[model samples]
Target chain A: MSSSSSSSSSTELSIPLHVKYIQSLGENKDDLIYHMTSHLRLNAIYWGLTALCVMNRQDALDREEMIAFVMSCWDEEAGGFGAHSGHDAHIHATLSAIQILILQDASDKIDVPRVVNCEPSKHIFHSRRTLPEMLTEGLPLLVILSLQQPSGVFAGDAFGEIDTRFSYIAVQSLSLLGQLDKLNVDKTVSYVLKCRNFDGGFGAVVGAESHAAMVFVCVALLAILDKLDEIDQETLAWWLAERQLPNGGLNGRPQKLEDVCYSFWVLSAMSILGKLTWIDADKLIQFILSAQDPENGGIADRPGDQPDVFHTLFGVAGLSLLGYPGLETIDPAYCLPESVTKRLGLRKNWKALPKRT
Target chain B: MPRVTSNNSDDEAQLYCEKSEWQDITPIPQYDGINPIAPIFYTPEYKDATEYFRAIVKADEVSERVLQLTYDIISMNPAHYSAWQYRYRTLVALKHPLDVELELMDAFAIKFLKTYQVWHHRRLLLTALRSSAPSPLSIASKELAFIIRALSTDTKNYHTWSYRQWLLAFFDDEELWEGELPYVERLLETDVRNNSAWHHRYFVVWGRVRAEGEIDVGDVLKREIAYTKDQIALAPNNPSAWNYLRGILEHTKTPFNSLRTFVELYSTQTAPGEEDIVDLDNPKPGPGAQLPCAPALEFLADIHEEMGGEQTKKAIEIWKSLGNEYDTMRKKYWEFRVKEALSV
Candidate 1:
C-alpha cells in the first residue's frame, strides 16, 4: 500500500488497517481507558460496527456477541437500554441499542407493540388516536415518547434536561420502531423550527447558536418527519457549503477549526436538502483521507490527532456519502447503511453523491 | 506499579467492597456467567465502586455513603448519568445542602467541561436551588458569575451558553436580562468572530417581544443594526456579524437595500488608499482588511437581488465574481444562487 511511508498525504483510505484497529479495540480488555469510557461503550460499539459496515467489512466484529452485549445493556425497568450493563437507562444508549439490534437483524429482541406498524393520517391529530396503551405500558415506544416535553422538545432522560438532539433521537427511534403513528409531529416540529437562526442553520436548543452537528439533527429529524418544507432549504444549503475551509475540512460553525466529523454533519444536512454538490467534494474527500492514521489504522478529528471509534465512523460515513470508492452508501438522514434503511422502509428523500467506480 | 503510601491515606486507596460497613451489601456484577459478551475488564477500584453502586441502587438506598460512592464513581467517569442522577436523588432525599454541593461541583464542572452530564447536573442543582433558597435572585447572579468564569475557559461552549440563556429566562428577572448585553459585548470585544457571543446578543436583544409601552421595537432594531455594522467594521470577513446583520434585517422585515451604501463600502474591490475615513453610521474596513471580503460581497449581492429588475443583474454580477474569483471554494453555491436568480 502507498501508506507504508510516513507521509500524511496518502490519498487512499487505509481500510484494512482501520479494520485491524477496530478488531484490536475489543482485545484491550485490561486497558483502563476501556473501563473509563464505559458510559459510551454502546455508542462506541455502534460507531465501530457502523464504520466496519461502511468499509464493507461488517464481519470484522462478531455479530452475535455484539448483539448480546447490546441486549445486556437493556434497562428492564426503564424499558430503555443504558450505555453499559449496570448503567442507568438513557435515551441515547437506547437509540444505539435499537440501531445495533436492527443492523444485526435482532430487533425482535426489543419488545415493541404490534400496533406501532399501523400508519395514521399524515400530520392529522386524531381525537381518539392518542398515546397507544401498549406504548404507554412498559415498552421502548413509551420509554421514548415519555421524554417528549409539552413544548415539543425532548429530554435526554428522566433528569429533565432537554435538547434538540434528544428530539432527533426520539424521532429516529420511533420511526425505526414503526411507531410514528403515535408521535405528535406538529408539536415536535414547531420546537425545531423555533431553533432556526438567521444564518439558516439550527441549534441544539432554542436561543442557541447554529452549529453543524445541530443542523444535522434538526434537518435529519425534519426529513424523517417529512417536514423539510418548513425549512429555507436554499439559505441553509448556502450556509452549509460555506462551512468548508481552505484546508478542505469542514468546521461545525463559522470561525472554528475544521474537524473530520463535520464532513458528515455538514454534508449530511446538505445531502438531505438535495444540495450535496454545493461544496467541493474532491477537496473534502482529500481532507477526510488525510485525517486517517496511515500506520496505526484509525481516523482522527484531524491529522496528527489521536484516532477513535467516533471519528473513525464519521470519517468513513462522510467518505461513503461523498462517493468514495469501494464503500457502501450511507443514508445521510438515518446515518445507517442505505441498504438497512431501505429494508426497514424508513428511508427519506435524502440523497447521497453517486458511488464512484 | 504499586499503590503509593501517600495515596493510600486518601479515599482513593479504599475499596468499597473491602469496607466493613458495606459487608451487608453484595456487589452485583454487570453480567451473568452464562454468556458474558465483551465485558469491560475494569480496574479493581472502578469495578468495586460500580458494583457497590449497583447494589445500593438495587437496595434503594440513598444515604451519605451512597453520595460518597456516586461522587467517586463520577470522578472516575463523568459521563456516568446514572451516578449523577442517583447522587442528585440522594442529595434531595437526604435534604443535603445543595449550595455546598454546587460549590464542590464548580471544580468538577471545570475539570469535565465537555461532559454533557456535568452541565445537566448543574442545571438540576439550580432548579432545586430555585425552590429551596429564600432568594432565587442571588442564585441567578452567582450562576451568571460562574458561567462568566466558565466562558473565560471556552467562550463558545454550547452547554455553558445555553445554560446561561436558560438561567436568565427561567429567572425572568429584569436585572439578569439587563446585564446580558454588556456581558455579550465584553465577549465580542475579546473576539469579534465569536459566533456564540453574536447569537447571545441576538437572544438578549430580541429574545422576548416587548409590550407596546415598554420599549420601542423600531429603536431597538436600529440600535442592533448599528451595533452589528460596527462589529462588521472591526472584521469585515466575519460571517457571524454579517449573519447577525441580515438576521436583524429579516426579523424587522427591513429591505436589504437599506444597508446598500454600507455593504458597498466593504464589497468594493478597489482599496480606500489610506484615506483614514471614519464614519460611525457606515464604518469602513481597516487598512489590513481584505477588500471585497466574501461575506460582505455575498451581502452586497443579496442587497442587489432584493432590489429586483435591473438591480438583479448587479446581484448576478457580484455572485459571478464570488464564484469565479473571490470565493471559489463555494463556487458551486454561488453559481446555484446565480442560476436561481436568473430563473426567477
Candidate 2:
C-alpha cells in the first residue's frame, strides 16, 4: 500500500475488507481511531513495530523512508496518531510517535517542534476544511479555554472530556514544548491533583479503578517535571508490580490477562525508579520473546499471535533493559538511551520531585 | 487497512523518525556481551521453559508421571514464578475444585513461599468457591492467614489486599469493626506506606461507620483525608491515593462542612486543565458550536443544587477571591442568569 498510489481508486481498493467490516460493527471509524490513538502508553511500540515493517526490507528502504511511511499514522490535522494507514488520529498514536521520535531523537527528521507546539486546532475553515479539520475541531481544551460557550469550561474553543489521562497529556504536551515556563504549573497541577485516586494510582477521575497505563502518564508527568516526590512511591511501586501477570507480562488491572504493551507501562515505571530488578527479568523477557513472530520480524502479545509493530517495540525494549546481549542497554530510568537521558540533563531523580502542594 | 491518513495536503511535511529507536528491539551491539538474548531464543535451553508450560496444561490427568513432570518444571525455574502461577490460574479457571484444593494449600505452604500468584489463584479460588456451595470462607481465612504469614511473599499484593476486602464484605459490621478493623490497624502499624492497608483500614472502620449511620463521620473523614494527603506526600503521582481520597470525600460530606475547604479543593484541585485535548467544538461559529459549554455549566449547576444556596454563595466568594470583586460578580452573575433565562 504505497501511500504514493497517485490514484484515489488505489487507496480505496486497498482498504481491507476486514477494516470495513470492523467499522461496520457499531462503532464509527472515529471511535476506533480515538480509542487506539488515545492509548499513549503504547507509543513506542507502534513506531518500533512500524519501523520493523519498513526497515526489514533492508537498505532497499532506508530509515528515513521508513519513518516517513510510519509518520503517515500521525493525523496532522487532528494532532493524533493512528494505528496504521487510513485510521483516525488519536492520543494513543500521538504518544507512540512522540515516544518513538524522542527515543530515536528523530525530532529533527520530523517537524518535532512544530507538532509539539501546534496550538489547539481551532479557527480552521470547517466548510472548506477536510475531515481532519472537522476532527481537530474536537480538541476539548482549546474549545473550553477558548470560551467558545458561555461558561468558562463550556465556552472553550475546543471540546474534550476533562479526564485525568488527557489532563496529564495535555499538560505534558505543553511541558514537552517548553511551554510550561509560560504556563501556570501551580493551577494546572492543582486541578490535576484532584483527579488523583486513593489507590495510589491515578485514573481518568477519582474513584475509578487505578489503570496502569494512565498511572504511567500521571507518574511520568510528575517525573519529567522533577516532581516524583508527590507520588506515593511504595504504593505506586506495589500497584505497578502487582500488575505483572503469572504469564510474565503486565496487565492493566488484576485478574486481567497480561498484554504486550503493559511491558512499557510496568517496565517504564520500574525503569524510572531503578527497580527493574525486583521483577523476574528473565521470565518477562522470555514471555516477550515468545510473543514475537520470528518469521515476520515483529512481535505479538502471545506466541503464534498475529504480529504487530507496537508489541514488537515493547517486547524488544523489555529484552534490552534486562541487559540482553548485543541489545543496546536502555536507560530503564527514563526508558531512553543512557546517552539521550543524559543529554536531557535529567536530575538524579529526574528533578526536584517536589511533594504535590 | 484504514487509509484515512492519506492526502496530498501535507505531502512535503511527512516527517521521518530516526533509526536508533529500533536499537532496543534488534540490539546488535550489546549481543557481543556475556548475557546475550537473541541466541538464547533460538537455543535448546529454552525448551526447558516450554516443558513446564506443557506440564501445567497437562496437570489434570493425576497420573504419577504427569504430576512428576509438572513438579520438575516448578522446581526447574523458581524465577519463572509466573509460569507456576499461570498453571494455577488455568487450573482455577477450569474449576477443578477438589484437584486444586489440597495441591493449592501445599503450594502456598511450600518451603520457600511466594504468594503473589498463589494469592491471585486463591482469590480466583475464593470467587469460584460459591458455585461449589461450601461458602469458601474457611479457605479464604486460611489463605488470608497464609498471606499474613508470608507478607514478605509480595508486600504490594493488591490480590491479597482486595481479597481481604471481599472477605470483609461478607462479614457483618460487628465482626468487621471489632475483629477485622484491629487486624487492618495492625497492618497499617507495620507499614504505613502500604496503600492496601490504608484502603483496607478505610473500608473496615469507615465502611462500618457508614453502614451503621455515619458514626464518627467527621473523625473518619479527617483520618482518611489525612492518609490520602500522606500518600500523595509519599508518591505524588499515585492515582490511587487520589482515588481513595475522592471515595472518602464523596462518602463523607462532613469534610466539605465549610466553604473554605470547598474553595480550597475546587479552585486548586477539582478537574485540572484539559488533559484529553479533544476537538469537542465545531468552531465554525453560527449555529455550528451552539451550547458546547452546556455540560460544564450543567455540572456546576448540579453541584450548586447539591449544596443548596450555600454553594452559590461560596462561588460568589471564590469569584471575588479570584479577583472578580463582589459587586461585579453579583452584577454579571445576575445579568448572565437573566440572559440565560430569557434565551430559554
Output the number of the TM-score-best candidate. 1
Tens digit per residue, CA lDDT, model 2, B25-79: 2212211222311111212322333333333333333332233233444444332
How high is the lDDT of residue B176 in model 1? 79
Q: Which candidate should be chosen as best, given lDDT against the real structure? A: 1
Off by over 4 Å in 2: A1-46, A49-61, A66-159, A195-198, A331-338, A344-357, B1-344
Across A137-210, the per-residue lDDT of candidate 1 in tens digits comes to 43778878899999999999887779999999999989987889899999999999999987799889887889
Model 1, range B1-344, lDDT digits (tens) per residue?
A: 44444224364677877666788898877663334566677778888898888788877897888888999988988877778889999999999989889988998988888888888888888888999888878977998999899889999898888888888877878877888899889889999999999889888888764666798878988888888888888888898998888888888899988998898888887656666566679878877888889888888888788778899999999899999999988888888888989898
Give the TM-scores of the predictions, in the order they appear. Answer: 0.92, 0.40
- Which residue pairs in candidate 1 have backbone atoms (N, alpha carbon, C) closer than 3 angstroms, thus clashing? none
Kindly list the per-residue Cα lDDT of model 2 for residues A204-284, writing each as its tens digit.
Answer: 433234567767766666666666776667556656765665567777764456887787777667666555555555556
Worst ten-residue run, lDDT, model 2 chain A?
A148-157
- What local distance difference test score does each model get? 0.84, 0.45
lDDT against true structure, model 1: 0.84
